[model samples]
Target: MRPAYKQILEAVVVTAELTGSELSAHAQEVMVDDLMAYPLDAVLQALTRCRKELKGRLTLAAILDRLDDGRPGADEAWGVVARALGDESETVVWTEEMAAAAAPARELMMLGDKVGARMAFRDAYERIVSDARSERRSVTWRVSPGSDAERRVAAIVRAVELGRLPAAQAQLLLPTQAVAERHLLLTGSVMTEQERRAGREHVKKLLGMLRGGKVQVARTAG
Candidate 1:
């Protein structure tokens, strides 16, 4: 093990011991070996989260679960793709794994097999994400700008608001229009400031409902 990694793992082991989950020397070695594949920063963060949130024994699996690499699960990935399919003019910002897995799913959709597409997408996405996580690859978000010139800004702005894209990078992607007018260009429809606030609040409520599992996935294809 590298000196830095060894030091961090030793600290982690000591912390685990204090939490009543003592690890044998051999077990510690094995854990270090497994974790060496991930970035040191990710491991450090995972250890911090595990220390605070984990009630049970600290194990490799538990640390791995806490590694927040910003990669979405199969279901969320599929949801993004499904929403994109609803409008050909819709811009999409997605991770590399999502784009790769989307290829076969798009082909399946073109052949009029939405169900098969969803199944294939889920399986391929899960596998891709797993391999990516194992290699400690950071999720790379890419933007696919649609043909609709007017909607591009709105999409990029939404991506920035959702924390999927950096604001500085988004500025480069946006058109020459001033940043002050972004709210006015949210959609084709014109709305007052009050209406915009209401719309934002409504969206927040819907997102909360979705996160709480109150909203079910529609059976129909987008």
Candidate 2:
């Protein structure tokens, strides 16, 4: 297979699995310059790892040659990177442990009282966003037929829990069937025992917000 094709496939697999996985903190870093987009270093690492593990399946020379030739979806790649590289996004410094995760779990205080809102992690992956060719890169479109509900639900909730989306807005992005399941999973699976107790205390808050009325469910995350 062509190096470009392999790169694209690897990106799709990683992106699809991102919902339940983690991202590193470097993804959150501010654009220090025009070049400050997707983590090439990490992508390089990934390619190298693929080469090492796949042995006969993938060759480092092929990937390296492609990288040098700018033959591996360079034009198509930049757009994905650009999306993740929004202007002036603030990124925290990277740590060794952070390098190990897909991306860092970021949080910032919202609301006047400084309640925490989670931030997106590795969703801003370099290759996914880099579309130098400016091709229309729809990661969702690449998902398998009939859609993958579990991945979708987890992603929406994560976006909401993180400051990437308004809770209501995130709710609207969910599929109708996935809504209840996601809420329960979030209200259950995401908490530590103490955190769960605190969240339960805010059951009234949850209901009150729900009382404002639900966001219309959509078929996909925009």
Candidate 3:
């Protein structure tokens, strides 16, 4: 453990007024080991949040919950998956946990059991998220493109705007003309017909790669 972490943990312990055997050297070592997986800044912020909000004894679980780790709650994750299920032409940017839970949910949805699919998705998502958090795995966001070109462009743009996708990487998933057009529009310029044709060819290649599973869009670390 870093000296800084040890100092912060001791500070948190004092602020929380934790007494008894909980302040033993062995217990502190265990806490440091568990917290070492997270970033120092995140750990500090979580401890600060715990200092302000915890109503009961400060526990590892409470501090973990307070970390801004970017993992969405089960209900929020389900909502994203459920929207994708309803729209075949909707592009989605999701975490690995959401994708993993989505498989079983999609299977149930295919059988016309929407309710069952939702319940299963929530349960699986929670379990997967818990395991991921325990393992100190950060969220990785990936794009799953849809068939609609316009919608795909819109989704990618929105993701980049929201900081869910990096702008540089999003360019790989978009057509050349789409990017050019957006740039031109922002600069009050226009795209030529030749440029449009070139963009179409780029789109075709992207679509082909997507079909072949050769285009693994960039993964954003959360």
Candidate 4:
């Protein structure tokens, strides 16, 4: 991929890290639309009807875009994300021989202690978890409206501090499926016949939903 595209992907992933869960089903759809650059009405409608900031949806979109980079319509999807995000369009500018050795021309700003950052993340996660609990919805480490993002970020920092996760996940965090795939491939364990068939069927059904217009659009496709 081009450097510009890679930058956009990186930005989306970072943005998702900033946003947490709390997004509705429709909001999640719009968020995906924004990150992948598909249609924008989905996101616009979601933003207009929703009372809150919809940060969760926005973040989720970025996460999915980064995690499922191999999905069909990757570039086209980023286009949509640009329109919905307005000025944030810069975040998704499509590129790929990117930032080489560059000079540190700007002033190096200092940051607070790690304790402060951790505390902030912890608080945010707690709030999201409390909200999810109140809604009576199950929160998973992957898609829950909680501090999963923060935790993942913390994990990366910890890994860097300890020199670990980079070799495995690279700069981007892996989704549940990605982690599983890597594990299976590394272990040299073949998927069982039933498992392989089931996986194929699941993919087929998902594609069918997207193409056949079975997608649960909370609003018009526009």
lDDT, each prediction? 0.76, 0.37, 0.76, 0.36
> Of the candidates shown, which would achieve the greatest TM-score relative to the real structure?
3
Kindly report which residue pairs in candidate 1 clash with one another: none
Worst 10 residues of 4 by lDDT: 97-106
Candidate 2 local distance difference test against the native: 0.37
Comparing 1 with 4 on lDDT, the higher-scoring candidate is: 1
TM-score of 1: 0.58
Model 1 residue 94 CA deviation (Å) reads 0.4
> What is the alpha-carbon lDDT for the whole of candidate 3?
0.76
Rank by lDDT, descending? 3, 1, 2, 4
Candidate 4 lDDT score relative to the true structure? 0.36
Q: Who is ahead in TM-score, 2 or 3? A: 3
Q: Where does model 4 exceed 4 Å of error?
A: 1-110, 141-222
Clashes of 3: 0
Encode model 3's per-residue lDDT on 53-84: one tens digit a residue. Answer: 87777777777877778877778888889878
Q: What is the lDDT of residue 62 in candidate 4?
A: 31
* 128-198 per-residue lDDT for model 1 (tens digits): 87778767777888788777866877778787877888776776777543233344434434677787677
Task: Report residue 10 deviation for candidate 1 (angstroms).
Answer: 11
Ten-residue region with minimum lDDT total, candidate 3: 213-222
